[model samples]
Target: MDTHTPASHEVKLSLQTDLTPAQAEILDNGAQQFLEKLVQRFASRVPQLLAARETRQAAIDAGTLPDFLPETAEIRNSEWKIQNIPTDLQDRRVEITGPVDRKMVINALNADVKVFMADFEDSFAPAWNEVLDGQRNLRDAVNGTIDYTNPENGKHYQLNDDPAVLICRVRGLHLPEKHLLWQGEAIPGCLFDFALYFYHNYQQLLAKGSGPYFYLPKLQAHQEAAWWSEVFSFTEDEFGLPRGTIKATVLIETLPAVFEMDEILYSLKEHIVGLNCGRWDYIFSYIKTLRNHPDRILPDRQVVTMEKPFLNAYSRLLVKTCHRRGAFAMGGMAAFIPSKDPERNEWVLNKIQTDKLLEANNGHDGTWVAHPGLASTAMAVFDGVLGERSNQLDISRSEDAPITAAELLAPCDGERTEDGMRHNIRVAVQYIEAWISGNGCVPIYGLMEDAATAEISRASIWQWIKHGKTLSNGQMVTKALFEQMLKEEMDVVKQEVGEARFAAGRYDEAAVLMSRLTTSDELVNFLTVPGYEYLS
Candidate 1:
């Protein structure tokens, strides 16, 4: 294999922080070659694909309902299924996810779960140092030497000898690794993450009984999955690996993706292993995808439980589709962090248990948790049903299963209480402050909140305001009402975090950002896009 390093002139490194010589060397390894190949093939295609989203939205705005694609109806009706579920991926009863920070990487991998999805997406704040250091940490983890001693607490942490199988969740297609510029354009964050990890650690992971595995996030359509398939193939061929060496679990987060499940799986059959329910993002997508329709406004985020009709239908469809297609139907994140208070912990655990039980009873092979503490609770639930079985893929859910796009689009009816509005305002401000200050996953009000939660919080506020929603108190929701609530929430946040930390916490910036996002007439696809620009 011949690979040449291109000069710095060929691609500009725009990282704001100074990278040490060693760090630079590691980042530059095979970067130029892989990036050049990625750009040559896929750069122009991204814009066109993104435009497809606009086209779909226009149809929705024009009152054409989204449904299973007739163009790919044969793919749905066909008897084909994804092939070759590797041993590591077969029994994913409980998967834990977190940012790629050193402590999280160590703890999550050491948590005794089946899979640890080290995320560069929703749970991570993509600062240049964070992204590079996350890469470095995972590399060390693959080599079985990821360890850290907290300087403040003097506690040492290391991975267990037998760690969870690692699956890297790259940034969604909409995000760019702005620190790295290829041909004067920000490199796609997905490629930067996928290439660096694959180039550096694929062989290492393969030698260690695991191969290059990924959890693809926020993919909107089958074409995006097809694009990922080609990238996987090209990377494998470039490195002299076999065609099917890479395996990906597509997160059917977006509403459009839910409609095109079979086609998405078929688009990458050789490389696809499972389909995950990215539950929070799906709600966020629903809000954004239907932002134009006044009547489709969702209820308060807290009221929209997993068992709600639309989400229930969505999860059922996902499980049925994945099982029928010979893929694991991985469930969504259990965002509750075990509370310190005994009573609160018990309450949270009960909720977690109930949620996990539903997924297991519905034939989902696994589910995700944000904290290691709840891993056992999730494992116990899945263990009860799965016992020794690897998965429930043999259970076929035919195409006529009970879910339709009309049902999916149906309005969720619930009273919008003042407490719910206050909760949204508080969470959006607090989460954004944490995100802009370099933490993306935060435990607030006993639940682990990520960017997805923040997205829903803000988007729901926007939708409510847009539709002139009335709170349970009968006060109309408007920009003025939202701002009033936001200011009160900022005061609450300031008091909660205290004077010194609140001042240093960038809460003011967060307040401004949160308010701006909700007040904007246009819907933003991702909060991380603007939030990334604020990070150091």
Candidate 2:
């Protein structure tokens, strides 16, 4: 496929395609390049506006969806116990409501690649207060305030480490309301000053001057990536932080993102961690994009398969693209974690393993773990993919790297201080608490579990951590290591507990009280693509 040789310093690339006569003629005339140049010129302003948004993003979550968006945190040194979370590859277990060591959580994560996203999005149903509460918990989780373990207790958050280690996917930037809008209002983002609003978003919040990271969703083009990159650059400049500290895990959710992967990846490579294939949105996008195609067909909502030929093609392309560029190639969402019915749960687990194997074999290094319960299992799959106990370190670009490979593999110390830990915990708690009352974690974790799942309960604990999380029962926790370890564990633990509670017949208390767990049926529902029903 790659007949072209690599330049001394450049990657060689080629595409194998059977083009029609008309397409061949356009290529000969360089029309594609001309069109691309035109697009870049026209799209410059769009990206500039997006960069402005990233520079000042705090204005968002004000319950006002800006016409535009800014885009898309951590802390360290304290005396939290190191015994509560994972620390080594062997510590795959996470404790709920009870105290465990952060070592265990780290072990679980490094042992496997399951990222425990403390969600205030799709995983929960959603109520206004719950949104607020979920945001608070997210802030706490980031800070490793283990006590935020229960928000009802009103504990303060305090953690240590870069919160980015615990990834988060926020609410989708869709219409304010689906079925209907107010007589005069007609939903948000339609008539809003999108560019200005978007500009102010990142500028305001990320300007806070430290730790900026996010998982961007619903992105659809290279133009969008460029816009976000500009915002990040501006925010870093204004905040006096290093450029690119604000890394993003961009989601290739819609059809356009998939087709334009080269562009998006090119635009944000320096700042992007990788691209994620959004399962539900991909199916929905296909339907919308191909609605006019007479030959293209789709299937019903319940039957998409990850192994379909088209999916296989899509996965292969993504993998090659990512690897060729020295970036991580992420797998698609494995929604359907273990369910209430053990049989269904086992089935889903098997399906997850199959999908994971496919992705790993195809060259994807990481996959999303939708719920806390699935974290350990997902990590197990990654272990198989990695084929060794050591971290998969990419070869350095130059010989002048600050740290040697041995140093990377060596045991180092990076803990959190009291103030730093408190700072991040505040952010995580604020995120989750805000979600409980505003948007809810379920909104973020939608594809993995049913909305209203108990992941909401963890919001309470995350809130408690917002206060100076004190673990006097019997452990000396350091805000430093726990900052990196147990901090992110709360999210996975919350979601897992939510599902467990729902199963244990505590629906009323677990799901209802955390009412922010639900979303309007329309928001959560999506139209399935015909002929592709087997690829979700």
Compose the digit string of candidate 2's lDDT tens values, residues 1-536.
11211123321112124445633442322322322232233333543544543443333223222221112101011111111111221211111110012322333223334244433334432332233333444443443453423357764433434322444444433323111122322222211112211222333333343233456666765666776677556545533555665666677766546656656666776677666666656655444333333233332233345665555656666665554455556677665545778887787788778877777666666676655566566667777767653322242222332222222112212232333333333333333432333322232222333222222222222322333233324223333434443345444445545766435432233222222212111111221111012111
TM-score of each: 0.96, 0.49
Residue by residue across 12-71, what tens digits does model 1's lDDT show?
A: 444445678857865774565676677677766877888898899889878776788889
lDDT of each: 0.87, 0.41
Query: Which candidate has the highest TM-score of all?
Result: 1
What are the clash counts of all predictions, listed in order?
Answer: 0, 167
After TM-score superposition, the amount by which residue 143's alpha carbon in candidate 1 deviates from its true location, in angstroms, is 0.4
Cα displacement (angstroms), candidate 1, residue 491, comes to 1.0
